[model samples]
Target: MTEHRIITIGREFGSGGHEIGNLLATRLDIPLYDNNLIRMVAEKLDIREETARAVDETTLNSFLAGFIFEPIEESSRLNGTEYVPPLTQQVYELQCDIIRKLAERGPCIIVGRCADFVLRDHKNCINVFICADWEDRVERIAAKYDISQRKAADKIKKMDRERRNYYESHTGQEWGSIDSHHMLLNVSRLGMDRTVDILERICR
Candidate 1:
């Protein structure tokens, strides 16, 4: 049997990362695990999908600082704390587990969630980071969300900040930095099809 190709993509907000992943998955005839990963985790863990989405691919904030100091075994004791919810840690762990399992299953494209770091040891893995110019990103977000350019830009800034903090906090690596990925592509430069072609070639 041939080893499956695994591609992990990390992208700046509104940089067409999800679209690229979808296209790549279609072109390669593999599953695209983007937001669906969150849904799967939520279902497996019996948690609300919204809760899963909130923390999905996102790092815990200072709000979780106190809990991290507590022993993992004793985490259940703090179930009722006003600052932390019982399912927070459970959801996070389930998400991580799902990511690992998906990679083991076969060829797939995983977008976001520090998947590159999670599967760093997988020999067949190829990690790519997608970014674009601020203006281009703003335009993409505006069109997708049907909001004004200024509002879109603001949303992009906020989302990217959260993603960066989440990635850095959990993986201890710089988000969108070249060091974190095998290839860094500016989606604006070559567009999605060319980017996918480039990645497919590199992975091959």
Candidate 2:
């Protein structure tokens, strides 16, 4: 019941969580951040957007940090080969810094990339998880992307898996677990506008 100024939304694939975040930001007259943060990370790291996105919200970030790169060993073996932290590690660390800075700057809506965990200490940040029934998720994704329900379901499965792995790896918490969020919203039931309205009231 604290006055939450920054909002972080963790959502299942195709649950309209992104849409809800955007609407909430608009209504609040604040910036909304999603994939845009990826671009920022990409630019800061001097890597292609596609490269940064390749590891975005996936276990590869941590996996590659410890396993995929043998830069230290390789450096000793090869002699004078500069060692850099894996790009995934850089992106994760940099993204965390960005998230914290954004929280400090002002109120805003941020979606995914483990923003909830990044700002867990913030006194006025609300972490929300958005979810929907599978059938409902498939319908929403299908309509939004103009794809068949079957394909939409497949897409949802893959994305949800990646996000789950990413969040669990970074936060040490189960993605979408009820305890992890201040509130769990079923956009399937509340719909986007009402969802925004409720969150808006809560943000007050």
Candidate 3:
């Protein structure tokens, strides 16, 4: 905490990244930004939280872009031409701005939402990527959601794909590439409590 480090955590689905972030934040006495960002973006755009959540960590399909986003106003048109960005893209830009401001403010932890890439230039930023064994992830998801293993596996695949697409599209980097992060952790092996302890020590 002496250096006011900014920690950005990226994780595979069901890897306990958010929970780890929450624990680290509590131990470090710093704020954590995760789903709370969805609310902030929702308020800024005057849209429902659900609407923001729908596009929070996914890219908008080109074919459905027009249907999902309204036309741009004449004054707001790019070079007098209709050039509306997808709602997902707009939300990302807004989130990037907000993330930058938060990092500038002080030490904190930001989970997912491509925060690592967003704060890449920050001098004290520590980017982490968390992954786990497939079976471990499946069990975690099933137990947490009270769903069948098959259903949990399906959800995990879908969520990870969306997160991968979103991150690659915006950052032009592999989602969990070792080159992109300062640390690559296997939470299943470390255990959530041990993972939190390690990260807390890193922050300190």
lDDT of each: 0.81, 0.85, 0.88
Sort the predicted structures by TM-score, highest score first: 3, 2, 1
> What is candidate 1's lDDT per residue for 1-204, written digit by digit as tens?
227789999999999999999988888889999889888977885657776677665554635322232234435544566343335565556677898888888889999988999889888889999999999999999999999999998999889988998788778999988899998999889988899899877766
lDDT (Cα, tens digit) per residue for candidate 3, span 108-163: 99999999998887889999998999999999999999999999999999999999
User: Judged by lDDT against the true structure, how good is candidate 2?
Assistant: 0.85
Task: Output the number of the TM-score-best candidate.
Answer: 3
The best candidate in terms of lDDT: 3
| Cα lDDT, model 2, residue 29 | 94
Model 3: residues with Cα > 4 Å off, grouped in runs: 1-3, 60-76
RMSD of each candidate relative to the true structure: 4.3, 4.2, 2.5
Candidate 1: stretches off by over 4 Å: 60-86
Clashing residue pairs, backbone N/CA/C < 3 A, model 3: none
Q: Which clashing pairs does model 2 show? A: none
